[model samples]
Target: MPQDRIKTIGRSRIQYGPLSDRVYLMQLAAGEAEAVITAMAELAQAEGYTKLFAKIPGKNAAVFEDAGFEIEAQIPDFYADGDKALFVSRFICKNRRRSCDAERIQKVLEAALKRAGAGIRHPLPSDWDLTFMTADRAEQMAALYSRVFDSYPFPIFDADYIRHSMDENFRYFGILQNATLIALASAERIESGVEMTDFATAPKHRRASLAAHLLAAMEADARQNGVKTAFTIARAVSYGINIMFARAGYTFGGTLVNNTNISGRVQSMNIWYKPLAPCPSNG
Candidate 1:
């Protein structure tokens, strides 16, 4: 992979950085706790990684915690049903630690929530349009992403990487002005829960509530498509997006400590969620 290191080990999909000290664990199924933990720690030491991060069902938190992983955050009822999700991290490389501005973020989040704008704004004029994107528009999407974010959590700003994710169950939506793509978001559905993320807006149009309009459109479409929930892991330090979610009526789920590498640094993230099923029609 031209991006991060991806490996499949015993029902787990692990993504790690060759030049970084962090690891992301996905699809972490049950069983083989000792083997996975031991092997991962040894590999982290050998490959110079400091921490391994995993977001899993809350029920599994205890098992991983017993294996040296510590709970960083929890989102209540995050699963499609009523199960919760917990973010955990294990330090394998000695003397290497990562800490976010948790105290500051708490204050910022609280203050931002007080000023949240609406989630769904009125539709734009005819000159502005919104459409669900495909792999062919990856270059445009990547360009906008690179412009908006100096560093992204994943290798999404790469066109080929976008196509790769498309093949692995990812979808994109774009906002266009005068037929030019301006803002974008994605909904990566896992079962009945959709991760409403990867949001970016062009610099000139940042104040126009394009994200809010786009989110409303996405949710309306998702409702028709059988989506049961929408959720996000928003950057904790960013007031704009955080407030946007709050305005949209998403419940605040807690903060993930130093969770993702974004905008050139490892930053903490906040979880926001809303149930999407069995609802009224969109305006």
Candidate 2:
């Protein structure tokens, strides 16, 4: 399946295509809510998309609610000014509103919640080298992502796309052994914080607690960079990722039902977030 295309409509960024079979209002600009809503609806109708997913400020929820959207999840203080980010959705296809894997999803959530605050930060293994990835390493990163995920919401398997994202606000990090990249993750800069995402570990390296170490390092780096918060939208049915976040002390915000197309299917996602200490002032 082709990757979704991200485009700008009325100052807001949207990702819509056959890959996810939905229109994702990824970012919304102030006061552009109505135009974005209308445009996304029109696009969804013309393309026969089954879902319209949006992440908007809580204050603007009323407008979207009036347009048939309902809040699926939310992260408080998601913005720098203390505004919450609401994950709202309107399912054009009735079946899309319900997850077929609801039982498994809930089980994962319960397991993760039981392990909350149990994550202990471990040092990077003696033989592993943890390094911040540059654009030159985009190919290696893309190769790792390709091996791990059959499909992703973003075009992470493309080397050029990885490079482009690095040039933007994304900072990729990798754990390597003997010069071979074994695990990878990235932190995307958002206003006053970063999104800790794109975590992938080589199959052979699983159960070694690599993700926990990476999460710790990412949090430290984000704090040093003046980031005030860190968050992730992980695959809801995945035990490892959800538990990892819970162990790392991230609070469970809620779930976005069938909101993301990942690993070759439309899957729901769980929101997790943590507040980070700000960088020290130079003065």
- Steric clash pairs (candidate 2): none
Candidate 1 runs further than 4 Å off: 18-20, 91-100, 115-118, 121-123, 279-283
- Global lDDT for candidate 1? 0.77
Candidate 2 Cα misplacement greater than 4 A, ranges: 121-123, 279-283
Q: Listing every candidate in turn, what is its Cα RMSD in Å to the true structure after a full C-alpha superposition?
A: 3.0, 1.3
List, residue by residue over 50-93, the lDDT tens digit for candidate 2: 99999898999999999999998888887878999888999999
Deviation from truth (RMSD, Å), model 2: 1.3
Output the TM-score of candidate 1.
0.88
What lDDT does model 2 reach? 0.92
Model 1 per-residue lDDT tens digits across residues 1-283: 2346778788767787753457777666667555666667777778787788877887777778898898776666667667877778886654444454767788779966786554455456677888989888899988999899877767877889888888887778898887789999988876567788899999999888888877887887778877777888898988778888888878777776666777777678888888786557678
Summing lDDT over every window of 10 consecutive residues in candidate 1, give the lowest-scoring window: 91-100
